[model samples]
Target: KEKVQAETFIKLVLLYNYRVERIKQFTNVTMGASTKEADIIVYNDDTCTKPHIVIECKNETISELEFLQAINQASAYAYALSGTIKYIWITTKSKNEYFLIDKDNNIKQSIPDIPQFGINKIQKYKYVYGGREQNQEAKKDKIKQQFFELETISEKDLINRFKQAHNSLWEGGKLDPSEAFDELDKLIFCKIWDEKIPRQKGEPYNFQIFKEPLPKNATKEQLLDIENKQTNDLFNRIITLYNQGKKEDPEVFKDNIRLSPQKVKTVVTYLESINLNITDLDSKGKAFETFMGSYFRGDFGQFFTPRNIVKFIVNSLPIDYKDKVLDTSCGSGGFLLYALNKIRLKADVFYKKDEIKHYKYWHDFASNNLFGIEISEKIARTAKMNMILHEAGHTNVISSDGLLQDIEIQKNSGNKEFKYNHFDYIITNPPFGSNVKQSEKPYLENYILGHKNINWLDPSKNECRDNQSTEILFIEQCYNFLKVGGILAIVLPDGILTNSSLQYVRNNIENWFRIIAIVSMPQTAFSPTGAGVKSSVMFLRKWNIQTTDKYKLIKQTLQEQIKKESCLKRKNRVSARSIEQPYPRDAFSN
Candidate 1:
């Protein structure tokens, strides 16, 4: 992505006032545990947490699949960044070519309200302005005057028409075609939105991946209906394809079908990835980018933060001086960074530390206090770059799972290392699925599910044998590391929160963590993930002793909620209260 160069240009504008750390991009590996590498990762050396200017290069006409592709990459960056970039500016070749990447995944994005592409009208006017192509004087003075007038009359109601033109001249305007483009860029950039659109004004369309998501507060029958509809759609498509048999161009057949739910969606998503078509400035550049995946990574990062949501998460939580923050499954490190900023700001406001002193300590303390673990190395790398923006390289983010260390040893007479003490605070959006499994390890002791200090895990149970489900173990592990009084606010699959099958797990954890609140999230909150696994923000605090009471608390709450639930009331319920109390390791509940 041109973001590396784009950031460099931005850094240049900031100059010595702000320092740029790295140039290569970064990414996390998604297998086993997360790992990291970089393409262009830069850390800002200055005290500032965000870039003075955020530049998102724009694309011209784009296809639907490309929009989805853009969402995936941009959402990842947005997920990874809690505080870094601000408002988005997509740089494109023409006036009608700008679009902001909505990092927040808000379905209701405010699109450009006006038709700015109208200024393409001035392209021909400039050609005849000067006889010679390189006449700088005649080009600037005259064309600039035209740009000044044309900008207002064109597509957008620019906030600063003169400023846009002046900045166009700032770079001396591309020298390729002197008079023609001297100040043409001003109009092109200022009127930065591509008006040539697809999805005819009112043309009906389904996302192809999904038309309507299972609605909020859906009935059990409604959920079942939604599921059945999807299953049928996929099954019908598969039957059609199977009956037709395979062909040279399998995806193109008019009657081609996909049978399985996974297969259909897989086919659609991959096709979308491959067929993401977007017209950028030069055709070659656009082609090369799609060929290299710049379309997704670049266009996605262009969207700025979902301001309201970020504020809500950051504002809702109140932090104190001694709290140690950890963000497991940290995507772009947005929450961690925002939390750090909040603490720094609050401390400065009340702690009596002078502005300069507090500023220095925030820069130093934030780098050390915030730790992140990301599952995707690519995303992790993005996270590191993001942390660097806040000048926080010392946060000790691991490319591996935060819940488990691949290489760790106990030192006898062990004084509790900060690493061993429970985290003071943990806020994260862990992967949602029983489908995520641990990477290949020599062995996992059955005892961990039961005993500890075994140095191995037995994969005997169906869940273990498949090793397809990875998240439950980490959920268990997050409980393990937190200190008795530490706070944890996390996003999890609702199933984990209330499922009776998890009673055993809950029994062990109830004493250690107390449920505080749960913020029901909308399905589209992470439209790109598309799983919509009934997610919720569950907050808790680790406690000591009193495991039974905690277990009771958890059970009673589940039962209470279940009573109010109209759908699952009659369905077979997992008995939280069995004939005899359940033991840890014997059952899984949390």
Candidate 2:
């Protein structure tokens, strides 16, 4: 493997027309100092007048830690060599990394990859502006202008502007709080769409999507006509993109934006200058969730799970690429999105770029494997949209009552139902403090913990309970959804974990699952949403039949012994007393 990597490095050098040598040894310049050796050295001449570059080669299977070690080794040799090396290259059979040296003889920065000798194909990227002014020279100037624009505006300013537009809709009674958010969502979508789709060349640079720019030379009436026309045209184009997105993932978007020209102008102006796609997903999620938190504080608070807790719970689970995952009370899709991100992180290392089928790797996993159930139509739509923005199409998120879905699963035991015992992992923050007692009989009949049933090892005791809390019911619901050996991570109220009255809940839990980990969250975990209840995140693995069969056998033997004892007592009493006289009615009853 090393030989192949070395050969590849040498060939790269020759292809660049640089004289190369396989440097087998480097003599120590000072006594008591160790010598250094590098895989290959490229020089400007055969005499090695100036070692132009040094290269380090490793096997293709090198781990990231080993790669870092190789970087240090390469750096040491470059510094120890007689002449200052202009560049350093580290190569495995499948990959390469390059670093540029600074005036202080330190690795200043890393580049995409080493540049070929004469070609110097490496080039920095710049934001391209829309309109007729799109020639290279014009673009260069526009990039300079854009730098000034970006420099003048901060993230806070961007957020404030977004809020300002949203506020306009609500403050003036133009739209309600929910409608205001929906409008903002559409406008933001349009802004993102504008950034992603480039404008045709020879068109005038129109910053209309962000804010309408006035015509340089026009009458007041003409200006009004042109600006209005431009705004309508941009919005129409955005609607077309929305239609396309619906075709790609039907669950993501809802109705088209029904904004007045003036309303569209307000939102566009407030958001036009920013690019949503370029921002990192973490930063975007944080900012957007924070913004949503305020709007969602009252009615939608239950759906607002803090991202910090979401991250903690998602990271704690051991997820795999092909595992079927579900967030059965998926509130705005925090758990599902985080799990998807974690799986993608593993895939980034496990598979090469060309080996991946983009649609199958991303869209299919989201559509087929990652599932969510949200009850509120509005919030469910929001969850779907959130998934789409994260590049995970939300095809599998069902907008219906989660409990109803579970009931259907219970009634229909067909394998094709794809409801229960199907998920490899179930992570959720189900609603608590709600009663599941309204439909008590059905729940008791359907759920394991809801009924009074015989003990697994000893059938003498009744182990059933009634009037279960929704959170308690969710525990069994999550378990039912998990296949044997599957994992469940749920956030529950502390009362369920600690209160003596709920010991039966724990007992039932133990009977069905193996407790993996329990983390107590702060009392303020949900305080931002006005919920001060202390909660904890619990992780459990489902127990298979083999693990519970021992208890079942013990229960069977105990029940049989109890039956025999009663029968023997009856026989003894009847044979001894009934023959002598009219047996006491007490003995007969006994």
Winning model by lDDT = 2
Cα RMSD (Å) per model? 26.8, 17.8
Q: Model 2, 1-590: lDDT tens per residue?
A: 56745576565655343434523323232213765556777665556657656778877545545766988888777777766566777765434556654424243344433444543333221124532243334434422221101112344544455566677667656478888887777666655655566555433222244223333444557655655765677666656766765565455566767777666655554454455666655555555666776777766889988889999988988887678998879978889988888866766676664565633565566767888888777788778767755767566776766665565633432223347788999999999898766355454546666665477544455644646677888888888889999999999999998999788688778777889989998888898788899999889999997776765576567768998998999999988886877756798574
* CA-lDDT, candidates in order: 0.42, 0.66
Judged by TM-score, which candidate is best?
2
**Tens digits of per-residue lDDT for model 1 on 1-590?**
35434544463334212234422234342333554332222233244343222333334233323434544443344334445432222322222111223343332221221111111112211112112332333345433312111111211212122223222333333322222122222122111111111333222112122323535555556655765675466445444434332242121122322123543343333121111112221232222222222212323331112224444676777776466777767765667767776877776675566567665666656755677766544455445544543445433654554444432412211212335455777776666553433345423332143322223233223233324234555555566656777777766666766899665545555555677877887866554433446667777877664764666677778866876784465443444344356666847766
Shift in Å, residue 248, candidate 2: 4.2
